[model samples]
Structures are given as C-alpha cells and as structure tokens.
Target: MTSFLTISLDFELHWGRFDKTRLRDYLEYYQETLQVVPAILEMFEHYGVHATWATVGSLMADNEEEWRAYMPTVLPQYKYERYSAYRWFDAQPQIWEEALFAPHLVRQLIDCPGQELGSHTFAHFYTCENGGSAKAFRADLKAAKTIAKSKFGQELKSLVFPRNQINEAALAISKEEGFDTVRTNPQDWYWKHTVDENLIKRLFRTGDTLVSLGQKTSYQAPQRNGEELLGLPASRLLRPFRKGSLFNQKRISRIKEEMEAAAKSGEVYHLWWHPHNFGHYPKENLRCLEDILQNFSVLKDTYGMESRSMGEF
Candidate 1:
C-alpha cells in the first residue's frame, strides 16, 4: 500500500468540555477557537492537506432554536448526569452563540478543498460512559446525519468517538447508520482504554509525544472489519503549542520523525487535535502546524506520501 497521512479534528467548541468545565471560565478560549478554525483551514489549503473535521452535530446549528430543532429524540443517559450534553443543554437553554454554535464554520469546512465533514456524534455523545447504550448512540448518529444533510447538503461518512471512547457496539451501529469509517485509538497499552481517571496511562500518552513510550506510532492501513467499517487508527495527537516550553521543538521533531518513518515504510500516519487546542496560542500553534505540514511536503515530494481524509480511506 502507498504511504498516507490523515488529519482529523475534533471540532466541538464547548460541548466537548462542558462536562468537565464551566462555560463561563472558557468563554474567551472558545471565542478564539472561532477564529483559529479558519486559519487552520487556510494553512491546510496552502499545504494541500486533506482532513476530516469530526464535528459535534449540535455545532452545525445556526442558533439555539435550530440546535433544539435538531436534537435527537432519544438522548444518551450517562449514569453520571454531567456526561450527558443534552442534560447540560437543558439546564442552560440560553445560547452562548460564539461558544456554542458555528454553522458558519461548518460551511467553511464544506467550502474548503479536500476537507471532509465527519461526525463526532450528536451532542458530543460519549459511548463508553456509564449508562450509554447502542440505542442512544444510533439516535445520536441519526441526528448527526440529519443535520448535516439538512443544513450543509452533505452526508457524513466518517466518525470520531468523543474522547476516543471507541465501543464495539457503537461501531456496529455507526455502520448501520451509513458511516463508512471511524478513527480508533492506537493499538498500544496506554491507548487501549479511555478512562480519564487513569493518571498513569494519561502520563504515558503525554510522555509518548516527546519520547517514545510505546510501539511504532505509524502502522499499515487497517483492513475493513466484518461490519465493513474502516478503522483509521490514530498515530499521534498534535498537542497544543505551549508558549516557551523547552520541549516544543522536541514534540514537533517526534512527529516529523514518525512521518519520515511512515513515508519510508509505506504506512499510514494519522494525526489529530481539537481546533480549540490552537485557540490559546494561535500564532505559535499555527506555526507548529505549518512546520509539520512543511515536513509533509518534503515527504510527499521525496517519497510519494499522500494526504487523505479519513473518509477517503
């Protein structure tokens, strides 16, 4: 198989973090995300990078009324009430427009060349959380497809589970709902589970970005499962740029070295992050992205590495 690089962004604004953070505290951070997304798209266009924006279905709404209009009939019933985004929306019905919804940004993704509109589930559904079921997951996927087709005239072919919480039943339901591809976590000990409370695994994930802590991050393209869903395993996260951090260059170098290895071995290297990751230090984060893309250009020219959206696989 040919060497490939895939980029997927978890494009939820506040919905992704609402369970763990106060909206008031992160307002400015999310507001900045509104600006960062377009800039990221511009860089992708310049670099001829193909990406999948795995968006929260709610963010596609133009306003609160529209978001409500598209809400799934059956909501995820996480045993931990806070994990349910629908319940959170119920408590705070009033919209924080810039922080909550972004149909305009969704439109930009559609307009951008080589960008694919993919699902991050309706309401940022957490599949692995307690009380979540296949029934709720199917409802979420339906709502996601409904809004994307109704608002943007696009059918979502790929999915990225919120928090990389991949569940087998959820994958089966995704295929039933017409999704052809989904991003899965790397097949490493640290990535096998998505428990947020596991500090050791989390530390290993963070350390792996700078120093190798696991197996080779890049891998051969995954074959389709019996369900016919393509499993696009993530290679690494493009961690947010830290201002004046001694390890910033090392982080970028780690990714470059992985990309080089993938290029030489004809494997797939998948990198992902949230657009809001660039919200805080836009200039620096974007520069880091450009640096990586520059390396991708070299790999493309020298080794025939190809850029692909997750859906394309």
Candidate 2:
C-alpha cells in the first residue's frame, strides 16, 4: 500500500500580538504579507498539491467596508482566522476601519482551489485546557456554521480545535454539533506511535510540540479511553521552523528526510500550520513550501502515495 500525505493549513487572520501592547507591530506585518495568500495558491497550483484549510468563520462576520478596500475579488464570509484581529478591532467597535479587511481575507481562501475551509472555531476557543468560556465557543460554532452555509454553500464537518485543546467532553459536544472528527494529541490518549515519553513530546504535536514521533498506528474508532471523542492525530512534523522564513538548506533537508521516510511507510502523514505565517514570510515561506512539495511529488511517483483531506483521514 502507498503511504498517504495530508497537508493541512489553518487559515486565520492576526491583527496583533497576543499582547495588546504589540498590536501595531503585528498589523504592519499583516499588511506587508497579505499577498502571500495568492502566492500560496500559485505554488500549490504549480505543484498539483491540495490541502485542508481549517478556516475562521468570523472573517465573514467582519464589518463590510474593509472588504472592498483590501481584497476586492475575494468573498469575505468564506474565510476567517488567517488574520488575527486584536488590533484590527476595538472595544467600542474600535478601528472599524480594519474590520473591512476581514471579509476579503475570507473571500480569498474560500475561492482558492484544493483548499477546504475546515473550522478553526470562532475566536479559537481553547476549550479543553484553558476553559475561558466553553459556552461562548458553542455559540461561535453555531454562528460559524450559519455563515458557512449561507456564504459558501458548504456544510462544516471537521474541526481543528483552538490550541489543539480537546477531550471527551469536547468531542461529545462536537459530535452533537455534527462534527465527526476532533484533533487531539496522540499519546497515552490514543494511537500512540511510540513508547518514549520525551521523544513523543515534540514531533507529533499541534499548536506546540507536546511530544516526538515515538511510533505509528492505524486509524481506529474511538474507544472508552480514546484521545478524543472523535480523534484525528496530526502525524507529521516540520523542522519546527518559524512559518515565515526559509531557514536554511539543513532544515529543509531534515524535513524532507522525515517526509521521505513516512512516504515509504504507508502510514498517514498529516501536516498543518497557520496561513498568516505565510503572510509573515511570504517569499521565504513559499520557497520552503516549494521544497516540501517537491519532495512530496517525488514520493508520489516513487511510492505511489496519495493525498487526502482532513475529512477522509
């Protein structure tokens, strides 16, 4: 059998830093790199590559004026999360100026080919670990689903929880909302690939490297002690580089080596990262992605590996 590859991206917007003080600094970064989205589509189109985009619904919910200014051709309701909005938004509906940017960002992603707008959840609710407001999260998903149906004409299914935070309760809630799969950390929870505790804490992780690639496992249904109510473990790891830049030949080599090995193994390699990172380092990141896809093309020919979407995985 062929080793499968799943390259997924969480497309969300970022207006400022998690810290309010650094808001302007981050907005400038967003302005400089917004063009990366189109560039990303160009590269993928060149490589015959497809990816899953865990989307943000709030982008469509953005105020309307900004949409006409920044992304004229793109539809706003179809995309969200790629642009972070702490600075773009204001307490009393502050900076209503930036709100228009949201819809355009959504439009670009929704119309992009081979990019599935998977849910990143409204406001990236970190439910499992830091339960700031689970109830609010529930409301966000409902709103997100509504926008998806009305704006994109698509039904939402898979979810990439904010912070990769999940548990049985989260999954139960997700399933109730018609979500079949919720991403989780693969460890003592479910489909643990290896036995080494430390090594497993780095490679096979989401948001952050919780562990390393310890072992590989098959796709199984949820069990009593499963990791998530519905589990989808991200199985591949990049070189842990920042999203914006091409680090060096060494880093690229290391990532390709790991991908090459997975291609030979017949196991599923699910890869993910944030879209705004592409905006941050558009040129360098595109080069890095180009190299990654080159390796993927090689494996596709040599091992007959196929690409899959998050729903299929």
Best by TM-score: 1
State the lDDT at 74 in candidate 1: 86
* lDDT of candidate 1 over 2-110, digit per residue (tens): 8999999999999899988888888889988999899999999999999999999999998888988999888877889999887887798465778989999999989
RMSD of 1: 1.3
Where is the poorest 10-residue window by lDDT in model 1?
89-98
Q: lDDT score, residue 227, model 2?
A: 38
Global CA lDDT of candidate 1, please? Answer: 0.91
List candidate 1 stretches off by more than 4 Å.
225-227
Residue-level lDDT of model 2, residues 1-313, one tens digit each, is 5676776676656422232344444665666456776777677777777776677665665564432222222122212323233223433233423422455656676676666667877544545333234454566677667777776787878788765666556666677777756555545342332223344443334313333334543233233344334466775444334644444565666556666777776666677677666555567777878888888899999988777666665
